[model samples]
Target: MSERHVTFDMIVQAVGAVAGITHHEIMVAGRAGADERVHLRYACWWLASKMTSLGPSAVGRLSGGRDHTMVIHGQRRAEELRATSESFRLSTDALLGTLQALERAGLLRFAVTIDPLATARRVLSAPEREAVRVSTYEIVAMSRLIVEQADGDPSEPSTEETAHAA
Candidate 1:
């Protein structure tokens, strides 16, 4: 396999890790097509475009075969959000930190400013951190429910199961 392929994979992993979603979710637009998902997708495109030799069209192709216009629009929107929204800026910074961590771990060859710890500390105030934690928990719980439903296992845990669960 080519180094580029590996780098692309790393990029995808980094995005998923920072966004708190699975790689599958990153690839799929999702049922709700929520703004959060769209933003993350845009972030993916922006990061790939910035870091790789690939043009907008190529980056678009990599990100769910989106058109070049979509790539341009998404990147532009993300850039605008970063300029205007503090939370969005922090989130993007956090993502950059993850990418940098990937680079440090030798999962990626490119150089990125890895300051996720510091940036997280600086950006996420106490209440914000708690919110993020709660949000993550909720997302995980919801994802689990979705998976169980998809598998045709909608039965709730019985008292016996709960009793032995702990």
Candidate 2:
């Protein structure tokens, strides 16, 4: 009804566009919880969608009135859990693939960075995507990164650690 309300609705739509969960579902899931800032709220919607259309009650309780952080933590935990569990990883890859499709459909942008227009072709190329799938390094890396970002903690990679991984 109000301009502020419209802006909030758009955020929900954008998140729904990316997660395919819809604004109505997010509203219902949220229950009576704190807003928890913008990015965190988006994370909440995504986790709620992932957990069997589960309402926002679980997430709300965990967030400590910080639904946004709760969302980030929940997704982070989901990703961490996904790493050692084959079925979980498969489920995630499937969900992410579907979400990426929606993003590619103009609902949102994946923003695959590139060196040049010529090099950009490789970003979405099947061979390139397949090349990156050398086991399950992504979920682990991403969850850690998200946790670090949300917690304001830097992910300091020691030179030895980097060299070892390399």
Candidate 3:
């Protein structure tokens, strides 16, 4: 049988199925609070990190364009929850066991090369897309600020912006 490699997309879908949530729910970055979906997101992060060779940054990008630090924090939170919550531990263990069994059966392999922006465009809702757009703008603004500082000319706009404005 051809080995079906696991991707972050698959992991998110699996976690959503296991948690009785929709993939959209899993992918959405909702407001931080006592939402149960947050735990599910953390679980997805933990599972993707453990099951794949992707680093925190890669996982973060694939998951939701989140920062690597947030991924790391989610991983730590998953560990803490596993230690303290028996139900959470059991659920995670069951999911891990299922994936391991698939690996052994040659049904699935843990390898992926994902394009974060492409995945974001495919999976993100309008609001999420807007968030990514704003992030891109912020990065451009920071770059312009750095260039201005280096050139010692705060009044001058970037050449690219000037060209666009013309």
Candidate 4:
């Protein structure tokens, strides 16, 4: 068989795609000086964000290849770096955008399902209004929401919700 190719970038892409998340410039290698800790810490953030386990304990556990203190140190350093570094900020935005794009491209996570039944009142059309009355109220994915605008809030309404009301 021809050699099946596998690389860190490919692995990260696969992981990200399966998680309904996205990332870019997935480099796997040794780091130099400050970059070493920064990269590992960044990886921790990226992975935890994808897993949505950003709590202190969860992140500490996940990032613990070294001592938990090291993970904490990295996390603190990254937070500090973000405070004053414009270039880092731009790079972070770019990386996050790549992840989001990968998600939209169906590379990282499962498709988000939609919710059909809503608790909306006086906001939907006559047909939608009636539909909600009969539909049971529950959480919905609602991937595609197309409704006429009413006030600023889509879920709530007030006297001002309908300016057309006389």
Top lDDT model: 3
Clashing pairs counted in every model: 0, 1, 0, 13
Off by over 4 Å in 1: 1-6, 31-33, 101-166
* Superposition error at 100 for model 2 (Å): 1.4
Give lDDT: candidate 2, residue 48: 45
Q: Give the per-residue lDDT digits (tens) of candidate 2, residues 7-47.
A: 22233445556555543344443445434233335443454
Once superposed on the true structure, which residue ranges of model 4 sit more than 4 Å away at CA? 1-40, 54-64, 109-166
Q: Which residues of candidate 3, in runs, are more than 4 Å off?
A: 1-4, 31-34, 116-166
Q: Which pairs of residues collide in model 2? A: 40-68
Q: Mind giving the per-residue lDDT tens digits that candidate 1 earns over 48-127?
A: 76555577887665565689899899889989988998988887778767665655566754333222233345445675
Give the per-residue lDDT digits (tens) of candidate 4, residues 1-166: 0221222233344444543433221222234443643553454454334434334454443332245555566556656666777765555555555655665555643322112334333335565344443322222212112221222334445566466575
Q: How much does each candidate deviate from the true structure in C-alpha RMSD?
A: 15.4, 17.3, 14.1, 18.4
The digit string of per-residue lDDT tens for model 3 on 61-159 reads 666578999999999999999999999999988887787677677786345444534544544556545444434533443453345335334446778
On TM-score, the candidate that comes out on top is 3
Rank candidates, TM-score, best first.
3, 1, 4, 2
Point out where model 2 deviates above 4 Å: 1-66, 107-166
Q: Give the clashing residue pairs of candidate 3, or none.
A: none
Clashing pairs in 1: none
TM-score (C-alpha, index-matched) for candidate 1: 0.55
